[model samples]
Structure formats: C-alpha cells, structure tokens
Target: MARHPVRAKDFAVGEEPATVVVGLIASPGPAAEMAEALVGGLARQMGERLPGARWSVRVVADRLVGGPAPLHELVARTRRRLLDGGWQLAVFLTDLPLQTARRPVVAHASSAHGVAVLSLPALGAVGVERRADEAIVRLVAVLVGGGDAPVDVKPSGDDGGGKHRDALLRRLRELGTVAGDDRGAGLVTGVITGNLRLLIGMLRANRPWRLAVELSRALVAAVAAGVFALVTNDIWLLADNLGWLRQTLVGAGSVLAVVLTLLLGADLWERAPPQRDPEVVRATREQVVLLNAVTVTTLVIGVLALYCALFVLSLVSVLLLVPPGLHAAALDHPTGFSDQVELAWLVSALATLGGALGAGLESDETVREAAYAYQPDRSLTG
Candidate 1:
C-alpha cells in the first residue's frame, strides 16, 4: 500500500486548519462599507499569515449585538450563530463605539470563541480605511493564535509588550464573564461619539454639486426677499417701529423655524431599519434618532451662518444702490444708525422665510439621498 499522507489531525505541530468566517456586523451605515472593503478583499492579505486556512467574508446585517446585554452573552450568541453557520471563527466589524473602563477600545477579540469585534470609530480622524484593514489583520492573528503570525499582525508594543494591545487582550480574555461587565459605562460615550460620526456621514453624503445648487437657490430667494423689502420701504417702516432687540429675536426665530420645518418635513431624521423585528431594531432606531437630531442641528446652524453672511452682503449692496443720505429725505421718520441695524434684522428675517421657499425647490429624493448617502446599499450586501 502507498504510504498515507499525514492526517490533518495528526499534523499537530501547527494550529488546526479551520474556516474563519469574517462577519461584517454593522448597523446599516458607512461602517458596512468599511467592513465590505475589509472582508471582501481580506483573503489575499490574510493568506500570507494563515496559509493553511480557508476564509469567507459575509455581511451579517441582521441580529445586532449593540444592546444592554452582557459582554459574554453577546459573544456567546454571536459565536453560536457563526459556528452553526459552518464557521470555525467569527469576526465582527461594527460601527458602534466600544470602550473599556473610561477609555475607548479599537478592537477586542476572544480566542476561546474565536470571535473578534472591531470598533470602527477607533480608526478615527483620517485614513480610516487603511487603519481598519490594519486593525482587522492584527485582530485576526489573536483569533487564530498570534504566535508565528505575519509581522503586520501585531496589535501593539514591540514583541507584544505594548500597553494598548495588552489591555485589549486582558479585556478579550474576560469576554462572556462578570469580569467584563462595565454597567453601561460605554453607552453615553458611544452615543456622543456615534452622533458625531452620523453628522460627518450625512455631510459626506451631500455631494458638492447638490450643496452648491441648494445654496444658490436659497441665496437667490433671500436676495429677492431682501431687495423687495428695501424697494417697498417695508424695512424703513419696520425699523422705525421695532427695537433692535425685537428685530434680532424675530430674525433668529425665523431661521430656527425654517430650519426645524425643513428637518421635519424632509424626514431626514428617520433611518431605514435593516431588520424586520421591531424589538430587534429598537436600539438601532434610538441611535438613528439621536444621530438624526445631531445632523439636523448641524445643518441648521450651517444654514443660519450662511444666511447671516448673505444678509450682510445684501445690506452692503442696498447701501450702494440707495445711500443712507437719500433714505433720510424719503423717510417720514429720521434715518439713524439704530434704524439701519433694525432694517438689517428685518431683511434677514424676511430672507430666512424666503430660504424656506428655496428649500422647497429641492426634490424630496435629493433630500433623502443626501441625508442617507453614506448608508450602505442593502442590495449590494448580497
């Protein structure tokens, strides 16, 4: 008989050859894109390290673990699902922010379950895509046993002595145990940071050309309103009657109202839920609500700032068209610096209302697309 090749189990000098399934677990946002890039093209890169194993990457958008559940419970549930799905190893790339103690963690892994979770926010500021790739590569090493892995698989410190990596390992070891409990310490921090990411995502979704068109429309409407006020002598009459304080408050209120209306009418605050169950998607919906509020507030503030700038320019243009000296002769009331200030406020307030009209010109689809542009296309997940 021909000599039998060494059996896979008998070849015990090396780690067992296993199928590692990288699960891109996300909340239906930009994090999905980050995960797709990481997992879809990860096999070639990971092949250099775990040459004996097979790798499969899939987007697990359903069954999110970002809840009040304990760490171990979360890990166990996720591990069970992955293993039952025919994966020996599972890794989750999540957009939700994760932390230990009072500090944020970039990634966490549990070798016992062969599961790892990476927090997308940890790769902050810039170079997020590159950092995400590096982080996953290192985390995978931990899942497969770090010894003899590729050079780039190191998490921190020279020779594995890095404090950051060590701390991460400590946390990883405590997964699915009482030792890992932090009693929701990370929730507040996660919400705050997650909202910031949401705002950035929304901004990124709005293309430059779309923003320009919207801004131009608003400016034209505002200019028309301002010029009409000046030409019809409404600004002078209102200025003579209203005090500066009242004028300022009215202008501020107008902008605020228009902003709120746009935010509400456009339904920019709502998020598309990825799962079917109401209870399962509740936490995600809450996150979307908080993030939507933040994004809408940021957009409103930006619009108000721009409106102020244009209002000043319009005032300057008005002065050039009809000087203050000419205004005094035509006015029934004495024209003074205070009056001019009041006129400016009135014009700004009226212009804000005009902006509401301009905002209406934007198609509903454009607003929705711009609002959720950063969100991953669910169809592409398949």
Candidate 2:
C-alpha cells in the first residue's frame, strides 16, 4: 500500500496551522525605510522557515525612544503596543544608538513579552539591511519557539552547513555580544567594531549632505563672494603667486572656520546633564562627548560639501567669463588650465570664509533639525 505525506496538522486531525501576526514598529526615517523594505520578504521567509505557523507582518512608523529609558520599561511599552494591536510578536527598530553598561546594544529580545528592540546604528554603517534581516528572523524564531530554542536561523540559501553558519555567527558577534538577565532573555550588547563603528553609523544617520542643502543663505553668500573674486585682478595675482601648499592650507583653514562658526553660532555643542547618581553622570558625559563628536563631524562634512560646490561653480565662471589670455596678462605670466584651477581654489576658500558669516542667518532650530544628535528630552536621569 502507498502512504501519503503527512502534513504538520495531521497529528491533530482537521486542525489548521496557527496564524502569527508580527508588528514592526519602526522610528521615522531610516528605521521606517528598512522596515518597509523588509516586511513582505521577511513575512514570507518566516512562513517558509518556521513551518508550524503562518506568519504575517505589519509596519508602523512612530518614535518610541528619544531619551534614556530603562530596558524593562521599553519592553513593557512595546509589549503593550503588541497586545493592543493583537500582534503575537513585536519588534521595535530604532535609529538611535543604545548602550547598557557602556557597551553598545544591537538587539534586545524578551521571550516572556514576545518583543525585541533593535538599535540600527549598533549594526554598523554597512550591510545593515542584510544584517537586520537575519537578526529579525533569528529573533522571531527565538520568540516563537520559547527561550530554550536555538538563537541561530540560517538563511534558506545557505548550503555550506557549519562553515557558513559559523561565518554568520561570527559576523553577528562582531556586531554585538549577547547579554541577558531575568528581565530579558536574549540581549545582544557590543559595539559594531569599536568606537569608530558608532561614529560612522552616527554620521550616516545624520546625512550631512542635507545640512549643506539647508544652508541656503550661506550658499548665496558663497556664490556672491566667488563672483566678486572672479572679477577682481588682485585675486588673479594672488592665485598666481600662492603655491599648491598654501592653497591647500587656505582651503583647510576656511573649512575649519566655517565649522567653528556653525558650532558656536548655532550652539550645536551639547553639555552633559546634571545627575545625582555618579553612574548616571558618567554615562551622560560619555553620551555628550559622542554627540559632540557627531555634531562636529557633521558640520565638517557639510561645510566641505559646500566648499566643493563653490569650487566647481568658481571654476566654471572662471572658464567662461575670463579668457586665458586676459588671465595671463593680469598675472604677468603665461597661464593654462592649472592657473584657472588655482584661481578657483583660492576663490572657493575666500567664499567659504564669507559663508561662515552667512551661517549666522540660519536659526538654531533649522540647524538642529538637520542634525541627528538633536534630542529635546535627552537626559540620562530621566
């Protein structure tokens, strides 16, 4: 006699596989983008890999974390959302970098609550999407299978067995360490690589190019200054005389000046919060330092992008408006393409200095909104 292949529900005759609904609550911006991009595929993958149940996913964009909050409290809040929405499992994806015991946290999962919180920055600045996909699958499996289940969930494409599995595990470990307690079952806490990974991740999240775009007044001032320098004979002479070393120095100095002006004028620097507890105070100080570093780096990148734009604009103006013969006559020497480039270089530097003055026109709120480090209620004591 021939036998039929048994289905999972066969043991409990006439039973259907349970449907498990998963909620992906993502913070606005990158977190939302990631969640939206992965939701459909993630749901399908979960259904295929975990055969006992059918999986469905929903994405919600809302800011869940802004200031310091206890891990248990965050879990509780997420659990409430899950229960309220009738979700069997919930994952909170945040762009903000999280830390516990001075170590960066990548993901924290609570089997009891059926919720997990992932700090995107702790995944590093590269390959974040793939890493996040793997994490979500593994976390979902762990949550659904109870705390005793294996944390590793190999991708369906993996055929190398232990080697591929080991490689994946190693990469995940590099992202963070697994730390947990009674409050949470699976807690992964460790820096991506070191402090540099956090800095790079923060920079990526800041999107400094947007900062350059927002400084409209400064850009106008820079263009005006570049135009004036292009028309002046004295600037032509100075560009002819100044060596490449001096030109580089001038450019670096101008960028530094703009960075400083923005930092001071806009008051972008952060000060550590006052707290009675020594640990809280220390943690806040570290956070302040990281925020300041991110702020300064953000300004530098923005100013440098502005400078590059000015240089390109000046170069085109010099090429179109001033003839090579006229430039050579003004410099009292034979000139070529290099002379035009040098002129543009110097003009951009001078224009950047003018931009520093124009930066004052931008309100503090405008600049702060463009930066990722701006958290209105960021207090460790809270």
Candidate 3:
C-alpha cells in the first residue's frame, strides 16, 4: 500500500515509505555549532539509509525557545508542526540538563510514534556529552527505526546488557584516571558531582539560594563539629552512651572523609599540563564573567577551608592531649578551673573545624577551574 506524505510527495518518489522527519532539537543558546554538526550528520546518515525517501531537517531552539513546558506543552508546538505537516517518525534531541534528575514524561506522550535519542535524556543517563555520545546515539536511532534498510543491525539476542554493563564498569574504573576532562568517560561520576558543583556555584552567586545553602552547610558543620568534639573530648562518652557499634561509626566517618577528600581533591588528580596559554586565550564576556567568578570563589573558599581543616586537625590533636594534661593539672591543683577552660577551647576548635569542612565540601571548585582552564599570562616585563 502506498500513501502520499504531507509535503513529502513533492520530493519522495511513488512507493516510498511513510514520511520520516529528522527533527533536531538543540539547546540553541549554548552549543549551536555542535548541534548543527550533529544534525547534519544525522540527516546525512538517514538520507544514505533511506535513499530519496524524503528527509526534512529542522532545529528547535529549546533555550531561546524557553523551557518548563510540561511534556505535551514542551513539544506541543513542535509536534503540531511535525504531525500535521506529515512527519510519521519524528526524532528529537537535547542536552541532559543538570537541574532535573528524572526526564520529562510528557516527552513520551507528545510523540505520535517518534524516537528521542542523542537527547539530553539519553546522554545524561549514559553520562556523556553529545560529542562523545554521537556514535551511540546513531546506533540507538538505527535500532528505533527498525534497522537501516541500507545497513541491517544484527539483533544478537543477547540484549547487549552484558556488554553495556561491562562498558559501564570499564568507564568507572577510568574515573580515577580522568576525573575532570570532558574527553574521557567516568560520565556517571562526572554528571553527579559536576552537576552538583555547577548548582552550588549558581546558588551561591544568587542571593536567596546562596543564603539557604550557606546556612545549611553551616548547620551541618556545626552538628558535625559538635558531635565530633563530644566524642573526642570524652573518648569513651559514646561507647558509654551508645555502645561500641554506634561509637565506631564516628571514627569510621572521620577516616572515610580523609580517604574521599584525597580521592576527589585536585592534588590526587593527574591533570595533563595545559597546552594553551590561558592569558592569550581571549574569553567571551560571558565566559570571563562566569569562569572568573567561579575561579576566584574556589580560591577564596579553598584557602579558608585549608585554614579551617588545619584548625580542626590541631584541635583534634589538642583534644587527644588535653584530657591527660588536664587530669594531671587537676590532680596537682584539684580546685583549679583553668583545665576546664582549656577543655572548652578544644571543643570550640573541633566545632570550628567541622563548620569549615562543611563549607569546603560545598565550595570546592578545583575541577571546575581545570575543566574550563584559561591560558596563563606570560606577558611579564623581561
């Protein structure tokens, strides 16, 4: 059975299959160049596969276009154009936005029977950007289209689950090696941690959210420091109160933080030396504004955090020492209150450490700096 397609008959020959629109929806504001290239690649591949089967290409700007439209609402305008205008098979694309954890369900409802891949949804789940994910997206698209009549995709019947899981594990193993670079894998870690860093910076820059995160971190720090101080000052306090298992958690948490910090910190990361001069590379007004601010904030927070960590470390050391010192002093002068005052000082220091660490965890910006690193200025007077 042959049916003429909407506006497609003008181009498609008789007996051509139903019209398929290769619509490329990109976040227009950020990566116009990249999206354009990917769309072109998709169109070319579909054309080669379908062979004069009437392929039309269109790009939707989701950003300049604005978002927050629910699934049907978001694609309402586009869907109308595609379905009414006669696109039987519609394919969509988008960058996985950091703000939302779950994808919009309405996206599924909007499609009359379309496929969305190379989308922010898929790339996000796979933990990679569009560039790295381009090939994977192509493979997925071919699968959705029931395999290319031009190039048949084998169904191996294996579900490819084993291979997919293996690839995921391999990527995870390389996370320690390529923690920051956009080129490599470790997408799972990158998306989760990198997105959090992005959100923290954004919230910090704005007033109300900034205040909220700051207050929350401060509170967490206070609680952490207070708890640690109590545990340290009275070594057997928790053991006496909660018994061995619960008391052990306090020490375990401390040890875990040390291990995690070392793993995540810039010091442990093996970054390749920058090839370009940061100063020579002229940043756009916007990049300079955002990157420079993030860079400065990171440095300030980092310095403050270092001092705070040292303070906590010193206080902890003092906590370990003071109890014995105070006991001896109290024995020598049983009525003296100076020993008690020193004990109070130790508690304050430990609490301060916890507070500082909380702030540091929130504000650590080293990876962000490396990701968008600038060329160093070597234009000093000779």
Candidate 4:
C-alpha cells in the first residue's frame, strides 16, 4: 500500500491542544470602554470569520504612554498568556491620538516563528485617530485579507422582515437621535431625517464607515461645488486670477462625487455595522436624487444672477472710464448711469429669483429621509 500514513492532519488530529488564541491590548482610564469595545468587536469579528480560533482580551494598565498602546508591553504580554494554547497569532490594536486621518491601522504579522502579530489603530475609536468612512472599510478589508469569494455588499431584494429598517433603528440609537423603546414610533421621524442625510453622504461619500461622519463633509463639498460653479462659469475667474493649479483643484472637487459614491459602496456603507433604516431606504434614494436636481437648479440660477451682476458692473466700469466733461445729455453721457441702473435692477431681480429658487428647492424630502435612514433604530444605536 502507498504510504498515506503520516499525513499533516494525522499528526495533529489526536493531539490534545487548546485552540489558537488571540491577544488584545489596549489602555486604561476613561478609554477603558473604547478598549473593551475594540476587544469585543475583534472577538466578534473573528468569531464570525475565523471560527476555529479562540481569543481573549488583555487590558494593559500602562498609563505611562497615555492612551496609545505600549508596543513593548503588548509584545511581552503576548508571550506570557497567548503562547500557551498553541496560539497562532496576536493582534495588538491601538489608537494614535496625535495623527490625522492617514494610515490608521498598523499590522505586524509574523507567522514563520509560529506566531503572527498585527498592531493596528482602532481608527475613530478615539477622537484623534479618526479616519473617514472609506478608510475604515479599507482597513477592515486589509485586516481580513480577501481569499474567499467576494460577498456582495448590496442588500438582497428579498423582504427579510425589513432588515434594513432594523439596521436603521440601530444607527439612530448610536447617533443619539432617538431613544426609548427598540420599536418606538417616536423615532420614525428621526429615521426619515437621518436616512436623508445618509443618502447624500452615501451618494457623495467615499467611505462606508462614514455613515456617521455627519454633515461637515457635505457642507464642505457643497461649498466647494458652489465655488466651482462660479469659477468655471467665468474662465477668467479661475484661469486668470487663481491660476491653473487652483482651477484644477476646483474642477476636481466638482467631479469627485462619483468617485466618492463608488468608494462608499465598496469600502464603507456595506461593511459597516447595520446602520440606516430599511423603510427609509426608498426615501434616502429619493432625497439623494432631489439633492442632485436642486444642486443643478441652484447652480444655473446662480450663474444667471452672476451674469446680470457682471453686466451691471461692466456698465459701472464703463462709466468710470469716461471723463465727467465728456458727459453731456443723457444719450451721450459716457458713464452710462441710466443703463447701469437698469442693469443693476435686473441683476438684483435675478439674484432674488435665484435665491428664491434655491429656497424653494429646500423641501423636507431630503431632510426627512436623511434623519430616518441614519437614526432609524434609536434603541439599538443609542
């Protein structure tokens, strides 16, 4: 018989052994909750993805380094507790409170020596090491390296008891937008408003984890778009004064929404813990569509108002060019005061129209949906 005898599985099959152990290290004090949450999240995540592995949380009370992880302390602890159970690896997650949004998670994997170590920042677990929504998704993907088949992030059309609604309810509570019962109707309104904000964010955001990033990003983008519309409307406004670099940046910002949306779909929203209400899903989509429409309308109106203003300003400028002595009869007056006044009034009217149109476009559709989607389940989220 061909020696099928000493197989790798056979060598370890009968051996009594504790399962692979994972070690978690974090700080103490007020950050204890954050540390515990990280450990809990990691354990849960690993349980779902790596069921074969066993894990434990170790809180290192080394306050010498403040809230950030102490690398040496973590490495020392790993050898003490985790290595006993035939542990395969140890991941030390920490928060870098001094850094910006760039490169949050740091992993140090080492498997050849019968042990692997990954030291990564929890990202936004603390206030300072906060990253964007997309960044969080990307980090997760990196940590949970993809080998298995790609799972679709989009919600299946199957009416699974409004899982989406349940998800939203969870988010609302997290955002403190609603409270009380898990299935309370008082939060229905919050769900609508929260969901609308989510749609705008998802459609215009590059990160899924940003389901909770708030309106700061949107406001910033809106301001950039408004500026771009003005500068692009008049080539000289940007090209002549701001130069090519500034013009390019402005143009890029105006067109980056699609890219943001794509990133959010892949790296952000789908992977994030259940957020946004399911019932509000439709409303969120509608709100996003309306925002696009309103954005266009406002841009057009703004351009028209600007044109009128420029025209009137041109007349005033022409008047400045003419000498007082050159002005004779109203017909021959060099300053063109009569024409300038007429143009200014036209400009004012157009400005008023644009402002009114912009105001009118601000329907509750977007706001309601934004609230609904994000803050859907106030109980779970809270």
lDDT of model 4 at residue 77?
A: 41
For 57-105, candidate 3 gives per-residue lDDT tens digits of 6665544235443232333344333333333333344453222224322
Q: Report the alpha-carbon TM-score of model 4 versus the true structure.
A: 0.24
Residue 142 of model 2, lDDT score: 52
* Number of the candidate with higher lDDT, 3 or 4: 3
lDDT of 4 by residue, 1-382 (tens): 1111112331246642123334443445434454554554554443333222233434443233444443333333433333332223334334343221223324332111111223233332445223322222222222222111221122323355234323322322222222222343434444445445333332232222222122233333333333333323232222234544554454344233322332232221211122266433333233223333323322333333333444454346435643434333233434345543443333333333333333333333321122122111111112
Highest lDDT against the true fold, candidate: 2
Taking all chains together, each candidate's TM-score versus the true structure is 0.48, 0.52, 0.27, 0.24
The window of 10 residues in a row where model 3 has the poorest summed lDDT is 373-382
Model 1: per-residue Cα lDDT at residue 210: 41
Q: Point out where model 2 deviates above 4 Å.
A: 1-193, 373-382
Q: Candidate 1 — worst ten consecutive residues by lDDT sum?
A: 173-182
Deviation in angstroms for 336 in model 1? 3.4
**What order do candidates take by TM-score, descending?**
2, 1, 3, 4
Q: Considering lDDT, where higher is better, how would the candidates rank from best to worst?
A: 2, 1, 3, 4
Better of 3 and 4 by TM-score: 3
Q: Evaluate all candidate structures by whole-model CA lDDT and list the values in order.
A: 0.53, 0.66, 0.37, 0.32
